[model samples]
Target chain A: MPIIEVRNLSKTFVTKDATVQALKEINFEVEEGDIYGIIGMSGAGKSTLVRCLNYLEVPTQGTVIVEGHDLSKLSGAELRSLRSSIGMIFQGFNLLMQSKVIDNVMFPLLIHKVTKAEAKKKAEQLLDTVGLSDKAQAYPAQLSGGQRQRVAIARALAMDPKILLCDEATSALDPQTTQSILQLLKKINRETGITIVIITHQMSVVREICHNVAIVQSGEIVERGLVEDIFTHPQSRAAKQLVIEGKDPDEFAKEQEAKSKAVPILHESRKIRIVFGTQSSFEPVIANMILTVGVPVNILRASTMDVGGTARGDMILGLPADPASQEKIISYLKERGLAVEEVQ
Target chain B: MTANEINMILTGVWQTVYMTLVSTLFGYVLGLPWGIALTVTAKEGLHPNKVVYRILDIAANIMRSVPFLIMLILVMPLTMLIVGKTYGSTATVVPLVISAAPLIARMVESSLNEVDHGVIEAAQSVGATNFQIVTRVLIGEARVSLVSGATITIGTVLGYSAMAGTIGGGGLGDIAIRYGYYRYQADILWTTVILLVLLVQLFQAIGTLISVRMDKRHI
Candidate 1:
């Protein structure tokens, strides 16, 4: 059985002025040890959907079955116990600012009624796993943002949870720090075989650590599959936009506008935009095609990036004015498994 | 000042301290729970109950709106019933506590509210019960702020204790009214006023020291 099966889950938040549907008919299943990513812009209900897995925000409809137990049918005590097995971290690194690092890690263990000595011992071990054993005596405010998040991770792992939920866990940190935290999360997943779920607006984050991904848009899952499939062939408009932008949409639009005025228009030639997945992007397919078919290709606008530790590129190639040569080049690219689309 | 007069002033200081400290303690006894209830019953709270929150919120507002002096006179009957008499330093505590409790409750409620909702959610995610969240997360996280609020409450209660003197409640205020205003002893009036100011400063200093020691944010 899948470790977590969410079926037709929906959530709506009601305020005095209006009722907002935060999640609508969301359906997904998490396998035993998959690093699942829920990717979306802000307000896409990614956080709400993750929270509903642990019942932090109760679903408005449908059921969540974890480990053969329907979460909606469980009693309060059963839910609490289930939650203990499902650990979650936050974007803000919500460590108890008042407590020492050790004590913060000890929080869940203490809540679970573990003896203080045993809790302390277990907390120390978890802190060691996160590589923060020396800073156990320090308060959260005394540490940097990255260190605080490490502490939060330690605290989350204190219960030896079966699943770990990360709600934008590295969003607050700088790029360098985000890389290190993602590495740490990946390491934990590899060593422990714990199922991990990451909710984020940053596609780069999902690309870095997630194996499977679901693209959420306005309270619905628009697309979901292997990270490689989504990155290589984004089927939906939202997924395509995410693949193109690779960051916040607003900022990307602003950046594109700033560069737009300075760039010259394309000349009179056939333009083909090809999206190369990790495997195809690295191979000398373009060079081999040019050498064999003898079609001179002009690169108009090309950008290559690493998505999920694999090289992928969105390249717009200017083909020769001859219709025969353009057709030959398109056929060659398609035969090699590259997703090709004609541009104006 | 003569030695005899200085001893009288010292006695007045003792009485003022006694009334302020005792009343502040009792005030918290009632107000802490009142504040917790206010926080937990509100719309955004852990266990929101509209009717309970509305009633308690309105009651706190009404109690706060009444000036301390007016409240003292208004609660005289209940004060007398509680303490057998409504004059002197010990008896004055009855009315002083009643006035300070509502103010303390409001302060406590605001302090608890300042605790981050994220922290509370973190606790809940770890399978913490509502009681555990309230006691360990809400109260634990807000401890520094609670202490800071308590300091302000202590200072305000000291001022209210002096107001008790107008109704024959013993303290520096009683001495100031009888020995300075009535008898035209300007020296006695100034002496009591200075003593009151010094007492407020002392309480403030001590409260700040304790709050600083308890604060883990800076260190």
Candidate 2:
């Protein structure tokens, strides 16, 4: 059975001037022990959707059934208890700046009336799991962003929650720091079998850790599937954009506006994106393809990306103006097990 | 100066110190919770109640708007009921507390409001009760600001305590009035003024030091 199930969930925010529908009929299920990623742009309602899972923001129109309990139907105390069962961490780390790391982690346990000694032991163990046992007495401001996030993770896990919700948890960290945090999360998920629901705008983050992903756009789930599948052959515009940008965000952004002129100018005939999974990445497929086709293909962009920890190579190649050579190259590349799609 | 005059000045110092410290203590006793209520009942607060917030809001505003001297006289009957007199340093405490509580409430509300919203959300996510969020997250996070507000409150209350001298409320203000203004003793007036300044500075320095030390937000 799915651990979390959302059906026809909609959230509408009514202000004085406007009634904004932040989420529209969002539907998805997170299976037990699954790492689910909800990816979107800034205003894509990913945060709102995550908030709905915990009922931090109640949905206006549907049911959220977590662990067989319809969240909206639960009483105040029952809801609170349910909330305690699900841990959440944020992009900002949201730690108590005044409290020591140990104290921050112990906060939820103490709130649940756990004995100080017992809570302390548990907090210490969690800190060890997150690799911050030595920094127990350190204040949050004294730690770096990555360290602070680890403390937050320790605190979230203090309750031994069945599910962990991460809302852009690594957006604030640098690339290396982001990788370390993601690795820590992956480790925790594996060891504890704790289901994790990650909400992020960065497709790279999803590709790095999530097994399944749902792409949100303007309060709707535009596309969703296995991370590898989406990376290889994105069917939706939102998914395709995210996939393309996931390779090089800065260049992709420039490419968006410049796409109208740059594509035609750069290549007179045709351009195709070839995505190679880990198996095909090791072979010199491109080199062999050039020799086999007997025509030089312009490498518009080539980079190897991390797709769920496995290296996947993606390249945008400009095919020759001659139709026969373009067809031959396309057919040859298809025969090699590379996922190819024409780039407009 | 005669030994008798010096002794009287010393008594005045004692009276002023007694009133200031006592009034500040009572002020926080009433103000801290009052401020918390104002904050928690606010529109964006934990258990936002428009009715409770408005009542508290209006009451605090009214108490703060009335000038301290008028409040001293205005609460004279209440003070007479509470302390059986409206003139001594102890009786002056009644009106001083009345005035200080509301101002402290405003300060406390502001301090608690300054706490990051994200921190409160984190606390709520962990299923902390509203009361727990108020006492632990909001109050704990705003401790530095609360201390700083208390310091400022102490200084303001001390100044108000001196103003009580206009009536029969006793303190250095009383001494300065009787000897300095009534008898035209410039030295006594300057001495009382200097002592009051020193006292204010002393409280301020101590408060600042405590606040700075308590602030863990910085390195």
What lDDT would each prediction earn against the true structure? 0.89, 0.91
Find the candidate with the highest lDDT and give its number.
2
lDDT digits (tens) for residues B67-127 of candidate 1: 9889888988988898888788988898888888889889989999999999999999999
Show what share of the native A-B interface contacts model 2 retains.
0.77
Off by over 4 Å in 2: A247-255, A258-267, A281-284, A287-293
Candidate 1 chain A, which ten residues in sequence have the lowest lDDT sum?
A: A244-253
lDDT of 2 by residue, B1-219 (tens): 678888988988898889888888898899889999999999889889999999999999999999999999999999999999888899999999999999999999999999999899888899998999998999999999999998999899888988999897888898888889999999999999999999999999999999999889998
Candidate 1 structure quality by residue, lDDT tens digits, A1-344 = 89999999999999989999999999999999999999988888899999999999999999999888999899999999999999999999988999999999999999999999999999989999999999999999999999999999999998999999999998899999999999999999999999999999888888888989999999999999998888777788788777755677546656668877766665567787788776785688879989978977998878877666777787879888888888999999999999887655
DockQ of all models, two decimals each: 0.87, 0.82
What's the TM-score of chain A alone for every prediction? 0.90, 0.94
Model 1 chain B, poorest ten-residue lDDT window?
B1-10
TM-score of chain B of each: 0.96, 0.98
Give candidate 1 regions above 4 Å deviation.
A253-283, A300-316, A341-344
- Candidate 2 local distance difference test against the native: 0.91
Per-residue lDDT value at A295 in model 2: 96
